[model samples]
Target: MDVVRSKDGTRIAYERRGSGPVVILVGGGLDDGSENEPLAAELARHFTTYNYARRGRGESGDTAPYALQREIEDIDALIGEAGRSSRLFGASSGGALALEAAASGLAVDSVAVYEVPYMADDAMVRHWAEYVDQLTVLLADGRHADAVELFMRLAGSSEEDVSGARSSSFWPGLEVLAPTLAYDAACLGDGQPPVGRLARITQPVLVATGGGPDPHLEGLRPSFFDEAADTIAAALPNAERRTIDGETHVADPQSFAAVLEHFFTSSGDFRQVSL
Candidate 1:
């Protein structure tokens, strides 16, 4: 693992692999970089991939009073470490963070995101607001386990599965990462698509979704991911919308990596669909 010091002096840990154009993998909720290693390995075949533990997870050091910009600084540090502008692939809420980074005008060459977890309707927004409130309270009280379970339930975990997970040895590991859930929530403010902010990003973006239903979000709404993807694609000045057939919220890493490779290697002009 390699380390980079962010602007705020937080020590960010990441593993760099492969030998080509740089692509940084940003993992979403509860991810500690390990979850993204599979996708990173696949991308590494053609791109030099950096799989890093986000702040507050894995081997990365955390600072007090986390802000969304701090996470952006972390990405900037990684780009500096790569010694050039780099493309980014962010999963779930991490996707939102990547968009934010690009919008902030960092050294991002381009971006690709998978189901950024932004809600499409008032109902879903209200539901997410409740989750945010509950999460905040739980974390404030330091009820890490409850916070983790609450997040699991929000992600559409079955009661039985939640019970099993709570008893499993991995549950403790999850608890340690619970605090970052708030960080992801902050990335998707009010659970609405940040159209204005997204429009400001001039970099080429690939906004992707799965054609199949997302079981993790089934209880919330139908075609939620697709709707969010459409909104994002429309909002962006330069973007393309692609739906991966038979893939749900959890994408097939190999297939997703292929899509990314194609985009990253291209001239980044997706003229077919763009605002």
Candidate 2:
């Protein structure tokens, strides 16, 4: 893993692969670069892939008093390290970060985001804050599994499914990263009310959601995905929205790769081709 220091001196780690125009992939809560490893390998076929670990995960460093702006700076540091304008793909909370960075003028060639949870409604914002507080308490009690379950439940996951997944292979890692749940909550905030501050993004943007026709989890509403798409479409200067039919929050790599290829390869402004 290659390392770069962010503006606040936290070490950001990333792995570079393949050999073409650069495309940096950012993962969401509790996720390191490994979360997108499969997708990155697929993209590597056509672009130089930079699979980055957001601060505090993998080989990255974490300083006390973390701020959302520092996370944005981590991305900027990667773009600068790439030494050229690079395409960015962020998932969930990571998607929110990418949009924030682009709006802040990071010189990204293009941006692609999947299922970012943004809401403009005030009621939802208040509800989200309460939920965050609940999860924080769960984490404080060393109930990582319970915290994960609560988060999934808040995201609309059914109790049965959460229980079922608890014994699965994925749950352990998610529990391990449970404490960082606050980081994602901070990135998302109450209802993710428009950082009305983001209308400045001029780079071509692609906003996507899962079309699997199911809520993220049982009991949780699907408003997060809907509001996220609406927010990006309304705020970005040049943006397109797509729904990946039959896919959900946990998308298959092949489906994700195809969506990425269609957007990044066909977006003429970013990558020029020779016939």
Candidate 3:
């Protein structure tokens, strides 16, 4: 692992592999770079891939008074180490951060995101606010395990799944990184698609979603993800929407890598090619 110091002097750890054009993998909540390593390795076949632990997770360091800009700076630090420019692929809320980085005027060549976890309804907006409030209280009260459970359920974990996780050996490690859940919440401001903010992004973007049933949650509509991806794609000036069939909310790494390889390696034009 190599380390880069963010603007705040916090050490950020990353793993690099393969060669060609650079592509940085940004993972979502509960991810500490390990979750993205498989995808990175696959993409490494044709491109240089860097998978880094977001601040407060894995080998990365954290500073006091966390802010979303701090996380952006962390990505900036990684970009610097990557020779000051790179394409990005983000999963779930990490997709939100990647767009924020690109919109913030970072040197991003292109972007691809999978299931960025956004809602467009008033009820869901209230639900998201409640989640943020309860999560804050739980973390403040030192109920890290409960916070993790809450987060999992928010991500569509069933009762049985939550119980199984609680009994698993990994539960303790999850608790240790529970506070960073708030960082992800901050990344997903208002839990709705930020069309105004997203419109500023001029980089070519691939907004993708899965077309299969959510394996973890029964009765969940496939449109849940498609609509989110569509909303985001429409907001961006240079973007395309894609739906990968027979994949879940978290896509199979190989399938996703194939789509990304096509998009990232495209010849400047955001359209006309199949993915």
Candidate 4:
């Protein structure tokens, strides 16, 4: 892994694979760059892939008091290190970060994202406060396990699914990263999509979601999944929507990469999509 210094002088760690135009993969909550290696490898043939650890996870250094702009600068630092304005693909909460980066006017070539967890109404937002409150208390008290469960609920995980995950040995890693959950909450901007800001994104963008008919999810309507994706796509000035039938939150990299390749390879323009 290589390191780049953020504007704040924090060391951001990243690994580059293959060769061609640079493409950076941003991982979602509780994940570092390692989780996106599958997708990075799939994209490597067509583009050089940079899989980097987000701040507070893996090898990246986290400065005191995480702020939204600091995270954006992390992406900017990677873009500078990549030696060009690169295409970025962020999954889940990381998608929210990528959108903010593009909207921040980082010299991005294109942006692609998967299921950014946008609320279609204020109902989710109302609960977001309580969720964050409880999560903050849990983390402050060092109850990492309970904090993880609260976060799972906020992410719409059912009790059964939460129990199952807790039983798994990998659950502790999530517990370790519990504090960073608040960072994702902050990036989401009060628990809804930032319509006005997203509208300012001038680069060609693709917003994608799982098109599963019955994927056995809990806490929200199944239809809401596609609705959230559509909401984000509608907000972006130059964005297209794509659905991968039968794919859910944990998407198959090979299948997801095809959609990404198609979107990124096409000669899409802000004027073409926005107008």
RMSD of each: 2.0, 3.9, 1.6, 2.6
Q: Order of candidates by TM-score, top first?
A: 3, 1, 4, 2
Ten consecutive residues with minimal summed lDDT in candidate 2? 266-275
lDDT of 4 by residue, 99-191 (tens): 999999998999999888777777877888788889889888999999888888777788888999999998988888888888888888787
> Which model scores highest in lDDT?
1
lDDT of 4 at 138: 89
User: Which candidate tops TM-score?
Assistant: 3
Clashing pairs in 1: none
True-structure lDDT of candidate 3: 0.88
Q: Looking at model 3, which ten-residue stretch has the lowest summed lDDT?
A: 266-275
Per-residue lDDT tens digits for candidate 1, residues 1-275, read 99999999999999999999999999999999988898999999999999999999999999988999999999999999999999999999999999999999999989999988898888888999999999999999999999999998888777877898999999899999999999999898899999999999998999987778765555646677778998999999999888778887778889878888988998855754421
Q: What TM-score does candidate 3 get on C-alpha atoms?
A: 0.96
Clashes of 2: 6
Worst 10 residues of 1 by lDDT: 266-275
What lDDT is reached at residue 108 by model 3?
93
lDDT of each: 0.90, 0.80, 0.88, 0.85
For residue 118, model 3's alpha carbon misses the true position, in angstroms, by: 0.9
Q: Model 3 misses residue 173 by how many Å?
A: 1.5
Candidate 1 local distance difference test against the native: 0.90
